[model samples]
Target: MKYFACFLPIISPEKSQQFRPQHLEYLEKGRNEGKIFANGKFADGSGGLVIYIAESSDEVVELARQDPYVSSGARGYEIHEWEMVTKAVIPK
Candidate 1:
């Protein structure tokens, strides 16, 4: 199951500052666990997105709910499933 998680900031930058570290730590854990495939903030800094792989969209949402940004009310997120019809692979 692949999902796209789009996170929009809900609080001021100053308030969000307090949760950044924990949020990044949570992402790190997800990355290490292979649940997070890709993640980045928008160029305009409006928000960020994370690509997740899980059993279902519900599972992805549940995992995203644990993010400090979401848990602390600093950001709101939406999760959508992704279907890859084709992908390009780099040679090893």
Candidate 2:
């Protein structure tokens, strides 16, 4: 499976907040399944991001559709296939 990044921009922040609990629950499930690589909202609160593993863009889109934000029509999103070329290691 390849990784895909889904960029979700909040269209209705208040509405999205109402479904936050459900959204977190869904994310936890995905994490436990090892399908979710990373997820977080932008520092400026503009939107959120999620990296997940999938075979194709369509599959990623379907998975994203399950998100409460999108399901509830409180956000809009775009999915892009990601290629990890290199990693940076921070010395502790």
In angstroms, how far off is 42's CA in candidate 1? Answer: 0.6
- Tens-place lDDT per residue, model 1, 18-82, is 89899899989998998887788888878788888788877888888898888788888877777
TM-score of each: 0.83, 0.90
Tens digits of lDDT, candidate 2, 1-92: 89999999999989889989998998999888877888999999998999988888888889899999899988899989999665777223
Model 2 scores a TM of 0.90
**What is the C-alpha RMSD, rounded to one decimal, of candidate 2?**
2.9
- The TM-score measured for candidate 1 stands at 0.83
| lDDT for position 5 in model 2 | 91
Count of residue pairs whose backbone atoms collide, per candidate: 0, 0
The prediction achieving the highest TM-score against the true structure is 2
* lDDT at residue 75 of model 1 (Cα atoms): 84
lDDT: which candidate is best?
Answer: 2
